[model samples]
Target: MKRIALTVSAILLLFATAEPKQKKAQPKKQEATSVQQEAMKVLMSGFSTDPRFTWKTQQDEAQRICSQYPSMEAMPAQAIQKVIQLSQADLRYPQWGIFWGDWREGKKIVENPRGGRFASYGFSDSPTDKGGNCYACHLIEKGMPGGTMGPNLYQYGKRWNITKENMNTQEALERVKAVYNIIYNSWSAFPCSSMPRFGHNGALSPEDVMNIVTYLLHPDSPVNK
Candidate 1:
């Protein structure tokens, strides 16, 4: 009887000791499984047509990185580096010798805001008559109001402060490149920037970009003057 009682007690003690370990392992396993399941859910979300009217080449890369983070997430540095290299490699400057055109024409391009066309793009000039749509994001001039989306461009040339040491012609050109890259490939500058890649998207010509740049950079231009 004593032997039987001892064996029973030993078995009960072994079960009692093992219970907490099993219980602790269960929640950890469940938490791990929950995390994995959540990741899978995000990765497997459905795709649809974006408002931009095209599934661009960089969209997949952007989505892949963006989906991993929580809402309002930024991309990793490695991914951003890849994006910058790709954007710069694909930076297509103005082929025509024309970089500056009439700023009056440029002004019209800024004011006219009626070029976004979906399936009904054929109702008007879809490709050629497209506006440069500057003021949509930028506050280009005091007379013209713009969305608060981008920074104010009023006296931007003077106020924006591009003061680098020894800002000679070469440095100026390099600064143009840096700024142009932002206007050309915003994703390169800021991975999650709301600014549109006007040149890259064929929304504006190089001449148009140049005129805008000239308006900002030229000492005589209103932006500087």
Candidate 2:
């Protein structure tokens, strides 16, 4: 009986010790959350307070949801659906409709590496700097250096089977619209994608996005060559 009582006492002591350790972990988690909040405040204070930049510091509904997960794989199904719904709902198209724009003009926007980036140190973008800076993430044309963060798009138009003979067909128009939607709001198709929502955020206008779509889907563009 004495031995059984000692065993019970040891088990009770273990439970008591484990309970405090579990309780202690809760405070550490709270402290970590506090630290993260403080860090965000410090980072936001470094940017200029210009009205144009105010949007950068603020998280929209979709952004607030996305910020909770580190990556798409970590996101819950409900969260992913919510983000996609929000992204699709916010899409806007050019008043002229979703037709091919000037591919040559589109090429300039694709290759030019200046636009939308803001800094106070003499590097702030001028209103005229409307380049998409696409080469930063994609290889649009042959012989052009580009990053590997995104898939190689050296012959994007050719891969899509876009040809001048059929470029005006309903199927081709559908393809054009699909690509346009992706550029305008990538999260509509890919929740939590690394691709920026250029048109959705006004970084690029609808016309600009249409031109980019033309650059990628028009057979005559160098992206097909």
Candidate 3:
């Protein structure tokens, strides 16, 4: 309870002083620092690890901030800065230069929900035990199905100027970067997003994410078609 109190205190303090709308230029004026202690305190207070699975350790710097300052409405300016810096620095990119794959397969990944990590899963789930679970957060397809935690992604390809011809062009690489950051660091994109850090954990592999990117950019894919 005391730990929670301290955390809650920090949250309140940060909020009591931060000016939200005026933060348009926040990124241009922030410094880097570690928020590990604060994050650990919050995690230990709210998380319990069963014998089967383990409480994920906060490794990435952005995670440390998210774990601690779970509420953006209460995140300190300094902490937010740290989170952005870490996310931008550690974005995981694909190795084979294959950012796009079969969008058909990607759609399946985003819809799956049976592979979340749990303590009863033996400390760690299999590497392949991941899901894009995008539908849980965004209005993806036009009339198919999806969740509303994220904005609609139906015309994502069109919004990004993706077409049958340029879906595989150099422009595709830039799109991949944007998508990667969105998955790995939602806060980096939207300071108060409720989206989970899919890449920060084992929820989605770089390969898996590439497929989703393809789903959004591939011309023949339903998103573009």
**TM-score comparison, 2 vs 3, better candidate:** 2
Separately for all candidates shown, the number of backbone clashes (residues 3 or more apart, or on different chains) is 0, 0, 5
Candidate 2 overall lDDT versus native: 0.77
Residues 86-125, candidate 3, lDDT per residue (tens digit)? 6666567677765677787777777777434431244555
User: What is the Cα-based lDDT of residue 117 in candidate 2?
Assistant: 48
Q: How accurate locally, in lDDT, is each candidate?
A: 0.56, 0.77, 0.64
The most accurate candidate by lDDT is 2
Q: Which candidate model has the greater lDDT, 1 or 3?
A: 3
User: For candidate 2, lDDT tens digit of each residue in 1-225?
Assistant: 786567544533443334334446888656655655665565566668887666776778898777666578888899999999999999899898988898887887777786444323245445456777888998778888998888888878877788889999999888888889998999999887888888777778788889889988888787888
Identify the superior model by lDDT, candidate 2 or candidate 3: 2
Worst 10 residues of 2 by lDDT: 11-20
Models 1 onward score TM values of 0.58, 0.79, 0.66
Instruction: List RMSD in Å for every model shown.
Output: 16.6, 13.0, 8.0
The candidate 1 region of ten consecutive residues with least summed lDDT is 114-123
Over 4 Å off in model 2, which ranges? 1-33, 118-127
Tell how far residue 151 is off in model 3, in angstroms. Answer: 0.3
Clash count, candidate 1: 0
Best by TM-score: 2
